[model samples]
Target chain A: MPTVHATIIARGGGSTFHRKNTCRVLGTPIIAYAIQTCQQAGFIDHVFVWSEDEEIRSIARSLGAHALERPHSMVHYYSGFATQEEWAAQRGRQIEVIAGGPGDVNVAFNCNNFLLRPETLAAMHCQAREDEAVGGVIAVAAVEPGLCLKTRDGSLFPFWNDLSVPRAEHPPLYRRTGVAVTFRERFRNGRMALAPFVVSREEAFDLQHAEELPLAEFYLRKRLGLLDSDRPAAGEGC
Target chain B: MRVTASIIVLERDARDGVRWDARMGGMRLLEHAVARLKGLPLVDELAVLTDCDALCDALGNTLACAGVPVRRLCPTCTTERFDYLTCEESRIRQQLLALEQAGLAGDVHCFGSWRLPLLSTRSWERMYHALLEDRIAARIVPLTTEDPNLYTPLGGDVASGRLFGVWAHPGRDRQEAPQLYRPAEACVAHLGRIRYPQPLTKGVEIAMTEAVTVRTAEDMPLAHFLWARQQAGRACHDSQDGGAGVP
Candidate 1:
């Protein structure tokens, strides 16, 4: 009976550097999508957006998420295992103020991520619920079987696999998506207890460059009805 | 507007001995259709009218779990494979009867189940808006394909975009002979009821400018390749995000 809570890390520069979580594609701000996906996940008890910018925090709050001003020092730090652990602790403290207790499951969800499906969040929650002993689960993409390792001497051979013999014989392989991680409070070392939640390559896409905006808009429009809001804009031209 | 999206599944079985319900991208074609439709935000309810036991068996649990209302518009009718146009006429007629029986009215979007594996969410959205925009003048907007493979067997005009019906009268529905050519992601919208054998009277048409249909065995490879390329491109983007405000 552990409460599931989520914290979205969304402090980015702006459209100026392509770091701004507010940098919008298809009319909706990028961070808004973070809030949206969290809502879709269904199991979250609380959704919080961590940011330093007043505008970004405003947007997050407007989109129905709790906003916390992030420390300037933590802004530029690349988040992975260490950041995830720290964020979980911060989340525990935040939840304590409201409910006077910490959730059993804490999710450190990163921004610039639009591809994670709601089912993914539900799956992570199910994992924690199924095994009280389970520590954490990180989103990963499964590489379609048939891969190999090559030596510096230019040798190519399957790595602990006989997949080359027949394509059907190979099993699935996973690679970290670096998007979202849900974990139990006590065991915060996500990398150690990393239960992989497999995502497709589409779900692995993370925005980094301004040039990728048009492309991201294209795909987002396909996935989300991003352009539905722009029907009026399109009507003007028609 | 509440959209009554009718998902039509034609009957298929092991009796055909043709894994016509072929597996692609790790799912049976019917399964992909059911899964993708579950994501559409515009659809208040999905009306799945099919006599095909396979579609029902494959989708029954998933649809039920999703909590979407489903109707099995019964008396599962079969179409003659030899007469393409006649089969299409029957196909649409079946959809119309199914919607009517389900007691669904107001803004209807109907498309073939086979088209499900290929059509993107954006296409469905466009189809929705197109219907709303033309509800004033047009009675039904037939979702037409563009040039390069409009269902020509049905006498779809390669010049403009006229299929068998909907412009004049479905029996001979075309405003002008050799209408504008268009087809794929085939669909039609109605304000309330779809009256066939009558001149379309007044209806605006929207053309989906992409090819995402699985009509024959030859189309499978192309559809599979296109889907694969799309996925590969999605997984290839990397974030070089360099900002302190991680919002």
Candidate 2:
């Protein structure tokens, strides 16, 4: 069997932005919570977290996982693909790399996404296992581009080109959820897409902003069967 | 010739102290040691070593009144630098030196304050065997229990956790780490520590279990410790070498 390796990229330093949101998990650093989820899935052969924080490294070690130190230059929030690429290049031994694409697939997840479902994972693994052509599965939620907009260079543009309508009236378009990314070995060779496998949007959610984190947490708590109805949803904007 | 073993209870923080300044302890530590030593048929004679002046005086008075001899040794410190060997070595050396200065000639055994439960008749036999008959390169024995405060909070409540053990070797220097003994493929005996929040077993239990024994300072006789030092000296040959012998 091909060894499955994962890298959870998070600085794990005390974040001024999401202090309350980040402090809820235990046994590992905030980022490692995702790494632990991967470890629990049994699909991962080796799990590593790329972080510059010594405490995070210690946390990973304590969790029985390896830690790859992210260089100072690559750790800045704006410095994107280069960090993931360098991290994958330096430490991608035997396992594949799943690079930047969506927040749900990344390490710093919302608190609500904690009780991730195994079937969703099973569906992806099934695709990867049966179809050699598919690199892996990327969990995604259907979104209507017209319902979302992107602001760049002090201007607002439609999130996707084909959707001419304003985003407020329409439902949100498809967004990739980072719950898990099962990649193939070939994907690490600079290929754009993985051996594609698809799963339900209900199995995924976005956790980009601080407000979205608690929503993810709330949903995750429900998924894990830990909470009952009437619990307030996590992350305000969600 | 009388064989007296100085069991030094060094200060848990210093590196070294004057021969008389080494022995330091209170009534509790000595009482525990004496209780553990009661069953040692071969011990012949034993003394407690401590550095605290008040502590030493009180312990000395207590032990003398109890009919067990006590003496004061130099001050020594405790450290976790390498399994606490530095602290163990200093205490052992201080006690030995105190015995020598007091004009008490005997084969003295030195122990640390933390080594209370490890000093029993069964352990004495094993140490004697390792030194005299077994002729083993190195023998590390296990302690009956681990520090409940650090490793196991409930004190062995978890059934399948790592088996806790202490190391024991005759003539091995406490300064040297266990890595040095790896070359000999040393013999290690794993002994379980009695569960915490409960009293320690009355004596060492030799029933079989799986554990690794490394070397600790509490297992050597004064003569063996002296021999180890001499061997280290011989191996040094030249003072520049700074002997790293079996001790």
Q: State which docking tier applies to candidate 2.
A: incorrect
Please state the CAPRI-style docking class of candidate 1: incorrect
Give residue B181's lDDT in candidate 1 (0 to 100).
Answer: 27
Off-target runs (Cα >4 Å) in candidate 1 are A14-17, A78-95, A144-171, A179-192, A224-238, B1-247
**DockQ of predicted model 1:** 0.01
Question: What are the TM-scores, per candidate, against the unseen true structure?
Answer: 0.41, 0.36
Task: Write one digit per residue (lDDT tens) for candidate 1, span A102-216.
Answer: 6667777766566677787677667645554446665655333322233343222223234113423443334344454445554754433445555665565555455445445
Q: Estimate candidate 2's alpha-carbon lDDT, on a 0 to 1 scale.
A: 0.39
The TM-scores that each candidate's chain B achieves against the reference are: 0.62, 0.42
How would you encode candidate 1's per-residue C-alpha lDDT over B149-239 as one tens digit per residue?
1121133222221122212232231213333322333354553534444213122233221244565564455455445544444344323
